[model samples]
Target: MDTTSVWRATAPKAALPSLQGDIATDVVIVGGGITGVTLALNLAEQGIPAVLLEARDAGFGSTGNSTGNLYETVSRGIHRIIDRWDKDVAHAVTVARREAVDQIERRVQKYGIGCGFRRCALYRYATSEEGKERVEKEYQGSLDAGLRVRWEPSLPPPFHPPHGQVMVLDNQAQFHPQAYVRELARQAAGHGCLIFEDSMVLEVDTDQRVVRTVRGKVSAKHIVLATHSPKGLHLVQAGMVVNREYGLATRIEKDGFPAGIFWGSGVDRISARELGVDDETYLICVGEEHKTGQEDANINLDRLEAAAAAHFHVRDIAFRWSAQNYAAADSLPYIGKDATGCFIATGFETDGLTWGTVAASIITDEIIGRDNLFAPLVKPSRFSPVKGAKGLVEENVAVLKSFIKDYVTDRPGIPLSQLMPGKGDIVKVAGESLAAYMDPNGNLLLVSPVCTHMKCKVHWNSVEKSWDCPCHGSRFAPDGTVIEGPATEPLQRHFLQDVE
Candidate 1:
């Protein structure tokens, strides 16, 4: 039950040091994923002094845990964009995304990056008649979006016969996203951009343009909040829907599956692909999306494993992981300056690998005073309430209920003695409810259940062994340190007892 992703397990790490003292640069990127690393390289190529900081390692967030599929169309369907906006807008989105995928290929080739980048056709097929209309509309939408799409009679091996329509979009690509980010960081570092790992930003003073880490600080004229959900409170969080999707990999024979991104929709939605890491071939299947902190992660992962086994070969599971995604209210990512004047890029949904590169390109263009055609589409200032109303309303209402549930309802807590090893719960200790966990060695660690982001009650994620905030997707380790999301501060820690 190892939670590390296949990509992260195989890719080489990007070795970098943590920030020691205060440093100044023209631009400071606050994430080391594809967006921040690419932005750092973009700035360095332009002879601009910049610094990149990562909370953990490069691509440790959604980048490393992603499906590694890159295409013009999104998982939610291109028909969504067309229906929300217009044909022209959909075309623009596809054009911009295509360019981003091409940019990745260019970087891999130009720098001789060993990321296993390859061009392949994307197959979006329906598993049953219920999803026929979806694939049909997606095909039409792709054509409207100016993509070279065609109706295919069948899909490649390992995929069952399409029950409905099969849309094939050629020239789409896939790669080892973790390796790409690691190599991108190296390229940026070689070009004079300072890259720091294990330098989590504890504070960001947008007014003074300063980022503070545990040991040092960074001062820059411009700041880009590329961290998945930006590192603090913002207007965008209220409009975004946070969800976690599961991904798993299992061993497969050589050339067992076709080298392509195949998405099936019917009884369920799943993305399947094949990866050859060194001498072993692995089949990756990803699906089972659910709201973070709302659903049981263990159950969701179990469903994913069952579905993969049901549809594919009966190989034993090797790697399992999950990633969080924020879908914007307006159906587009917020990728520019907010009211706070600091640049923010979020709400990339599940297409972060491509949208992240687009964000870096747009942000870099703005910093260099260059006009980018796609900048206007994803600007943070744009308001599309009508188009984004469905998700915005649904998600905000859930947030409101979380507040009510935390305060109004009573949660039955268990005694510390009953809390088993490798288990956690809201335990009743000393007449107070505390977030408690018993380590494998029988150590009881306690923390406040209140979320530091907006005071929502934290729920235990049994699968990941962390406290997750239902309102804003903030997650904390068993020791209460922030893992991701908008919370910069760790959960308040409390000492209760040690089981001996």
Candidate 2:
């Protein structure tokens, strides 16, 4: 089971050059995913000179690995939005999401991105009576939010029908996100935006508006922290909770699969969508979400595979991948100037593909000195004591527990020779906890188990072959390179002899 996403595996490679020497621009964007690339394109279209820096290729992060469902509705659902805020706010959020989807459609057609963009309906169904009641609430909420929704007693086939009830939202979409983003990057570059790939940003000096990479420096009037959860910002990081979800693409007979985005209601929610790759169609199923670093990826993958097999006719599993998303305490993404005067965007949860584009639209407006109506809804500095207080306390308590437990517990007192090939463990060596992974060739790779973000212990992710921090969701490769962040530094590598 390859952990690489089907989007990344199928899309053409990005050819942007890496940053070199010192460069200056009007704005410096850190990250190359959908948010960063979309922001770059937005600014470039307005004749702004922006430099987009990516540690890897465009769309290589969560955007490429996303299930690629573009929705006007969110995972928390419309009813929850109404409960959390008000009917007006919920309606406004729905409008903004619809605008974001329209913007993506416009761009794809205008630029001819060839990203397999298609408009489809979205169906959310229930399996139990309680689930059906929840779906009914969502249907009413959708109507209250000014969205056209239909309540059906049964859903179309390929989906197990005769359950409880279903709520349908029309005009939703899906696409090859990598292709869309890479094309946006290419267009941005053509419009005089400098796009750099494989250029890791080391530090950001918000006061001076400067970003430093290992080999180059970028002096800009503004900086956008589009690096998923906004690394290096303690205040913003504290207001969010991270969760990891698994996705699998399985081969489906052409025309045999149903054409719509399907979501099940309840704790164990399952989402499925039909996707066409080359001439073959693949049924993309995603679910099994858990707190980052709290559960085994293999178990989640098994659950996803089992769900797919039960619902539809599967030819073969084509791809397996996992993605992490941040959930803001207030249930709205933070997309405005932080306390340090730097622009930031994060906490999109399962709706990142749509909300990320919305963030881009807002941030781009801010950078261009234009007023955006939705800016206040997602302001980074805004705090809701009533709406967000409970979530804030619960999430931080979990983080605190992980930090304390990791430090107090002793690592396994096993010798390195006991590690099986392709296996990893946290072992005690020289009275210190070290992470050890043995490759197929019998070479032992060791690194400090302590997370660079907040000194929390990193657990081994067997499915992705990475070390994931439970506290802030920073992830590192087996050899200690940073993959995801709030932590800019890699895990400290140690030699076998040094650990012994």
Candidate 3:
């Protein structure tokens, strides 16, 4: 999805200039999103001189588009982790995540960030009877893992769990992710930390603990790759993360509605939250999770719109955006040293806001020579037998699919019969033709099949009805408006040619 409306709309102008000529600093932190900024702030508190650089503006990446759920619960199904990992490892992972959420709440109060943060309950509902049983089992596992949770029979609006089984975790919370990150940036800069915008890191020498960027280089005692995906120059960081996409958001009136965060299971995973800014209360609804960068596009938005209408009678969609993030197969993110002085923090799955904070805390502790309990659990190099085979199979399948999609398929055109009136099919649009799915009413929605930034074909996300870029994580609307980026430009429109 394009960044046209997602977090880009909420961005307050660039905070600093792009990296220019060469300069040196005590510590150079790459990526200015939530993870990097949070680390800088944490380091500042300890009187560490740090420098932050962004290829674009802060929050331009996954951090800006996040739904801002400070949740400890796993976004990837917990069942997968439990089945794949040892019980002790899974339990420790959950505890560390919960601790991270708690730490953010403390930071908000300690720094007076005032980012519209609120304590709320989060629910995961079972759509089918079988799913209900699954929820019950997971709820028990969570209890055994020492989490605060309750199993209920029903959920609030838009979702009636006929299975009568839902898992509710209290003290879970939500906030304006962009606002919170901006607050952290402000505090970091105030503490003598230097920030450089538009400074993309080109290389990293872990042996020397130096990061080289387009603008300059910084030699520090340690380096952190807080970039959403590890931008490895000489080392392999791919195993640390897997990327995925989320649906567009429509703003809704929050009146007489239960206040909190919500998600339901099915082919169409639905998520919603009641958000407020000043005097306005809006509902942010999202879903349609697919492997990051699938081939289908523009369908995710339709699913989101339908969910909104069914649940909230949504009158207007004030903001529409898409997001991509790395989800570690083992559940916990890779958050520790890579080489002598190099550190990495990726694959927070769907809860980067909380996970990013935890990453900062752990990495900061290591840099400062302090002992942190989470270090062992979130170690970057820890090997899991479960992730080895399953992850390998999944990755190979994805690569094979990409090959077939790139070399075999006749992309010049698709048949009209493949498209139902209400459903969209990707065809040539503007200069590029890709996935374009329709709604129940058969409105033609067009999007770029190729990602604006990385050229990987965007996938039509049926669950959410939006075009999702598999490479570099960009999303676009049916009309070609960007919802997220590594790509700043809106997708070129191509429906006119289709009509011709």
lDDT digits (tens) for residues 8-89 of candidate 2: 9889887989988998889999999999999999999999999999998999999998988998989768887788888898
Candidate 1 — number of clashing residue pairs?
0
- Please provide the root mean square deviation of candidate 3 (C-alpha atoms, Å): 6.4
Assess each prediction's global lDDT (C-alpha) against the native: 0.90, 0.87, 0.68
TM-score of each: 0.98, 0.97, 0.79
Task: Select the stronger candidate by lDDT from 1 and 3.
Answer: 1
- What would the per-residue lDDT of candidate 1 be over residues 1-500, giving only the tens digit for each residue? 46999999999989999999999999999999999999999999999999999999999999999999998888898888988899898899988999999999999999999988999999999878878888998888888888889888888776778886588888999999999999999999999999999999999998899999999999999999999898888998999999999999989899989888999888868889999988899999999998888888999998888888778854588899999999998678899889888899999999999999999999999999999998999998888889999988989998988888877786678987799999989988778888998889998789989999999999999988999998989999999999996999999889755321
Tell me the TM-score of model 3.
0.79
Cα shift from native, residue 72, model 2 (Å): 1.1
Rank by lDDT, descending?
A: 1, 2, 3
On TM-score, the candidate that comes out on top is: 1
Highest lDDT among the candidates is held by which one? 1
Pairs of colliding residues, candidate 1: none
Error of 2 at 256 (Å): 1.4
Question: Which regions of candidate 3 fall more than 4 Å away from where they truly are?
Answer: 1-14, 157-162, 205-210, 233-243, 339-341, 408-500
Native-to-model Cα distance after best TM-score fit, residue 466 in candidate 2, in Å: 0.5
* Model 1: residues with Cα > 4 Å off, grouped in runs: 497-500
